[model samples]
Target: MIQRLLFAGLLSGLVVALFAFSFARVYAEPTIERAISLEEGGAHKHAAVEKGTISRSTQRNAGLFTGVAAYCTALGGFLAIGMAFLHGRLSVRPRSAVWTLALTGYVALVLVPQLKYPASPPGVGSAETIGVRTELYFVMILASAVCMAASVWIAFRIRRRMGMALSLAIATGLLVALAAVLMTIMPAVSETPRDFPRGLLFEFRLHAALMQLIVWGGLGFLFGRVAEHVVEHDRPAGVVRHRIPNA
Candidate 1:
């Protein structure tokens, strides 16, 4: 069963990676090129190409696909393990359980952290502060995940008495409160160059968030379908007991 789930996850990841790669190649790549140009002080494209060992064409093509494929495939494997552990425990159908987990995972790991520290394109932040920025971002994700887990546990404990709707509302409120506190307490990091084009920065950040949305949403939708089939196939057959009259 674990092997099958892992296989399903890997397949879904590969499928989504294609769509993500296409989107990146078309939309994100141009933005990246422009950012590089800006970083190079509007130097000729060839200058930027000469600076890096890898050409822009290669970076946007094979390099891009390889990175996306590997990330999505690993995410898929984790998603499958989550599904396996959470399958019957949620008291919901397999599809709903899978999607719920995906959505919550995105919120905890991606959305909340991004809210605090939005993604920056190349040439935005200084090389010196990259380590500090990375450490802070990781801390934010960990805090968000812990908060989400705690809220879920609280909801589950009270769900039977409070009903699903109220339980969920309470959990959501707790998540929000915790996130708000964390965001307030965490030190802010503003590293974007003062002269950077605001419009370009916005576009790049928007694309980055959308790309993540595509990956998570696609994984949930595709994996949900596979999980349904797996659950039904593994379900035990119903047994009918016959009463025998005393002989």
Candidate 2:
């Protein structure tokens, strides 16, 4: 099952890479180019130099695809492991699981931390604080992951007593409160240049968010289908079943 999931994950990574790359090329790339142009046009502009060993063509093509694919592959593996732990427990069907995985992934991985440390264009942040920014971002990621897990456990426990709907509601409220508190307490990073185009910044962040939605949602649905097929085939022969039931 793990082996099959790994293969499924790699395939999903390809799917993510295709969509994400397309979106980046069309929407994000223009904004990025605009930012770079501004950087070069300003007083900080440097003299034009010879092309580096790794050409822009390669960076836009091979580098972009390879990086996204590799990251998605690893993400898929982690997602698969997480699902495995919840497989027999959750009452989720394979199709619903798609949303579950995608929503949880986006919330815990992207949305939560993004509220604190949003993505920036190339020239927005200072070079000197790159390391500090990176460290804080990752720390937020870790905190969000932990909080998500705890929320799930709390919801599960409450479900046993308060019932599913109410339990989920309570858990969600708690999670939101915790996340809000964290956002307030976490070190802030306000690095975007004052002169940067607000329109371009919004577009860049919007497209970036959409890319993640596509990657995670696409990967979840694909992996869920693959997992369902595997589960059906693996079920006992003597057991009576109808069309690989949800959950």
Candidate with the greatest lDDT versus the true structure: 1
Q: How does each model score on TM-score?
A: 0.91, 0.89
Per-candidate alpha-carbon RMSD to the true structure: 6.0, 3.5
lDDT of 2 by residue, 1-247 (tens): 6666567667776777788888778777888777666766772222232235987678777888888888788777776776666666567665566558768878988999998898887667776788899999999999998888889889877786788788889989988988998899999998776777789889888878888888888788777787777666767889865443221
Instruction: List model 1 lDDT by residue over 1-247, tens digit each.
Output: 7778889999999999999999888898899989887777743222222287888789999999999999899989999999899765666777887799889999999999999999988777776678899999999999999999999999988887888899899999999999999999998999776778789899999999999999999999998899788877776789432332212
Q: What RMSD does model 1 have?
A: 6.0
